[model samples]
Target: MLIAHIPGALLGLLIGNIIDRNLAIKSWADLRTRLPVRAQPQLNAEQVLFMLLGHLAKSTGRVSAAHIQSARAEMQRLQLSAAAQKRAIAAFTQGKDCALTDLRSALRSHYAADKAEQLLTAGWRIAYAQGLATAKQRRILQRCADWLNYPAASFSRLEAQLMPTRLRPNSAGNELEAALQLLGVTRSTSLAQVKQAYRRKVSVHHPDKLMGAGAPPAQLRAATEKTRALHQAYALVRKHLQG
Candidate 1:
């Protein structure tokens, strides 16, 4: 009778352990299934956007070390899970092969403009994080922004803000003047001064740089909201000055 009781006790313990592990695994699997179909391992819409943007940032054919590092930092700063971050890195390195347009369309289909803009803004920052936003990168970002319903001017403003300081304003337009003023450069400022000012201002507003400095949520929100106005103002200013 003693021997019989010991075997039954052992069997019960084994069954309990198996049940616990199975429950844990099922829970894990269910959580994963709940994630975006396109973005496995990510648990939320925000994480899906990050993964999408990370992929787009690398699509420009540059993919610098700084870009990769900055993307990782942004992921952490945004408080994304480790699994999601790894998925984002992998998806980004995969580049344009992933059909980003479909994802963008889905975002527009499912979310509001503000939410989609956040994703696009993060992508733009990631692309420019490497210190240069090439034409190819710009096009990719622009398309994404457009699909996400972000005003076209937003990209221009962000680009203007990102431009090197040495780029002198040659246009006579109000927009040009405003951009110059925004960068703290006067019409009489020397080319060198212009470059320096641009560098300083650009660095201050650079998303990756701001991320490193632990920028506040309000500031980030403001930047996104105001980017379109800035772009329009910068464009008018650049055209006028350059003419």
Candidate 2:
């Protein structure tokens, strides 16, 4: 009823928000404890490999002997159980060749974009368990970021803050660019200007928009993660400006 008095634009927004909330709640309820018993939760195939790209980065130049072994070792540990582990490995061996999407309505029937994204975030962490995260690892992670429609820089900044030390120093520029790009601002942007830009960017990147885009599972996951990082970036930059 409140929306009835609003302008067309605002009315549409209010209605959309309600629909998204309903869908999210439904997704939460359906997936709460329904993780596949023997399967790796119904995430996209691209999501799995995109994460594998992160793991593979840990041993890029030396992807010879120990790298794959390390991935397997980590995979074994990350897998929930023996059966899941086998399936995970089988999925990994398929590598870049994995299937991405399925029949349209079938996909729509099976997963709302939000649920697909949740599964994608799960996969990214699994890819990181193998220890070493090199530049190559960052690149693969970037692709995962892209799939989730994430601003790669924002997550990298979060990673930098959480880790405190860089695996390499030179990459800071790359990371910053990623964050700034997500904010829809560039380094040339003044401090005060960034805040407005940040708010606007977050408003647009919301998972709700991704859902409206008919985002695939990977994109939904990416957007969700990016939204989080975008918030973090806004805070960090705001603090930097205040100081």
Candidate 3:
């Protein structure tokens, strides 16, 4: 029997190569384990908006018919397909069940400034669906605004802009104040200043402009209401000033 063997140096070199290859493979695996993972996909703006609306509706302990109606109105305005509407409902339901912190985090992750403002406007509409926002609803909405980097004052302003007409103050003094606030002016402001403010508010809240901007039907209605309020406010202010 003849036994053939490779030289010791060649065998040693082959063994070294195999060891190096194994080490390289192990290093790659270790690096992979250490690498940052891709984050879970964040919810989109519509989902977050609907979820927040759901959370807002449930904030006071029970969801009301008005809240459901408001959500449906938003869906209609969006012209969502039947499947998308179903998803919106699911997201809203999830919002009712999910933690507030989770919803806030999702909102912050998914929405930019303008879009976040629009979502917050929708939230205000939902909160005011039954005329006025309850304390719990206001707190939830304020927290959401804060999460989106909107100041508390801005939240209050937005709330004022969307306040239900039937719920607005009817007293002479309060009406005057609300008018001034709506016009972004004050009693001390000159008539010229008041006119400027009124025009500015009208331009911003005009239903035509809102519609042109692709605002939903619900938003258009809100804008129309706001415009009407602005006219009333302007007239009241002008009357008070002229007299």
Candidate with best TM-score: 3
**Alpha carbon lDDT of residue 212, candidate 2?**
72
lDDT of each: 0.63, 0.56, 0.85
Error of 3 at 102 (Å): 0.6
| Per-residue lDDT over 1-243 for candidate 3, one digit per residue giving the tens place of the 0 to 100 score | 122387778888787789667755456677577679989766877888898899999887899999999999999989999998998999999889878898767788776576667888888899988867998888887887888888777777888889877677775778888888888887899999999888987887789987667888899999889889999989999999999
Q: State, as a TM-score between 0 and 1, how close model 2 is to the true structure.
A: 0.31
User: Which structure among the candidates has the greatest lDDT?
Assistant: 3
**Top-down lDDT ranking:** 3, 1, 2
Which residue ranges in model 3 land beyond 4 Å of their true spot? Answer: 1-41, 171-243
Q: For model 2, how does the per-residue alpha-carbon lDDT over 1-243 read when each residue is reduced to its tens digit? A: 865678999888777689667755456566555555675455454335433533453334433444455446555555546666666556555543432332223233333345444333443443344444456555554554555555556656645543423333545545666677768777767888998898787787789987877889998888888789998777766655566
Task: Tell me the tens digit of each residue's lDDT in model 1 across 1-243.
Answer: 765667877989777689767765456687576567783442346545655665656566655677777677777777867777776666555543566664654566545566755666666667667656667767776776777667768767766765545442543344466777776667776666665665565555555655667889887767554554455544544454465
RMSD of 3: 19.0
Over 4 Å off, model 2: 1-66, 69-79, 96-137, 159-243
Predictions: Cα RMSD each: 20.6, 29.4, 19.0
Q: What TM-scores do the predictions have?
A: 0.45, 0.31, 0.53
lDDT of 1: 0.63
In candidate 2 the C-alpha lDDT for residue 236 amounts to: 61
